[model samples]
Target: MIARIWHGRTRVDDFERYSDFLIERAIPDYKNTEGFIKLVFLRKKTEKEAHFTLITFWKDIDAIKKFAGEDYEKAKYYEEDRKFLLEFEENVEHYDVFAEEYA
Candidate 1:
């Protein structure tokens, strides 16, 4: 498995709206894309910003490419993101999944 990780932030006050945006819009888009295994959105609230990390799991690099296109390393954005995100990240980090355990 491959993990595609992206970090982003929103103003503390807009946190809930941003989370809703992710669920209503982003998640659907991800589901429509090829090779999407799962998505987890983590949020941490601070005085200045609400930090968010989107961890997406894919079957493999090829599956990521299907969603991310030829330049899968490049962070892709949608029109809705501009409303919530303070800055658009240039790149996303990827890691190979070694192992996992669940109850």
Candidate 2:
């Protein structure tokens, strides 16, 4: 499995709204892609901004390329994201999952 990690930040006031958008839109959008395994969405609010990290699991690099296009390292953004994010990061990091388990 491959784990793709992306990070973003928005104003503190937009935290809940951003989270809602992910639940309502982004999650569903990713689910439709082939080889989608699951998503681990994370967030934190500081004095100035709300940070979000999206870790999406896929079957392999090909599966990621399907969603991310041939340049899989580039970060993917949605239209609605413009309303929330402070800046767009250039790339995402992918890791080969060696081991994972849930208790």
Candidate 3:
């Protein structure tokens, strides 16, 4: 499995609205994609901005390319994201998932 990590930030006031967008739009889009495993959304708010980290799991690099195109390292952004994001990052980090278990 591969874990793709992406980071973004929004104005503090837009935090909840952005989170809702992720839940309503992003999560569903990811779920519908082939080889999608799961995702975790992490957020931290400061006085000026709210930082968000999206960690998504996929079956392999081929599966990721299905969603991310041939340049899999580049970040994927939706049209609606422009409204909330402070800046558009060009790339995301990927890691090998060696172990996971449920208690």
Clashes of each: 0, 0, 0
Which scores higher on TM-score, 2 or 3? 2
Q: Best to worst by TM-score, what's the order?
A: 2, 3, 1
User: Which of the two candidates, 1 or 3, achieves a greater TM-score against the reference?
Assistant: 3
Q: In angstroms, what RMSD does candidate 1 have relative to the true structure?
A: 0.9
C-alpha positional error of residue 96 in candidate 2 after TM-score superposition, expressed in Å: 0.3
lDDT of 1: 0.91
**Which candidate comes out best when scored by TM-score?**
2
Error of 2 at 70 (Å): 0.8
lDDT of 1 by residue, 2-102 (tens): 99999999999999999998899889988997889998989999989999999999999999998888899989788988888999999999999999889
What is the TM-score (0 to 1) of candidate 1?
A: 0.95
Question: Scored by Cα lDDT, where does model 3 land?
Answer: 0.96
Q: Write the per-residue lDDT of candidate 2 for residues 26-51, one digit (tens) a residue.
A: 99878999999999999999998999
Q: What does candidate 3's lDDT look like per residue over 1-103, in tens digits? A: 9999999999999999999999999999889889999999999999889999999999999999988899999999999999999999999999999999989
User: Candidate 2 at residue 79, lDDT?
Assistant: 96
User: After best superposition, candidate 3 residue 3: deviation in angstroms?
Assistant: 0.1
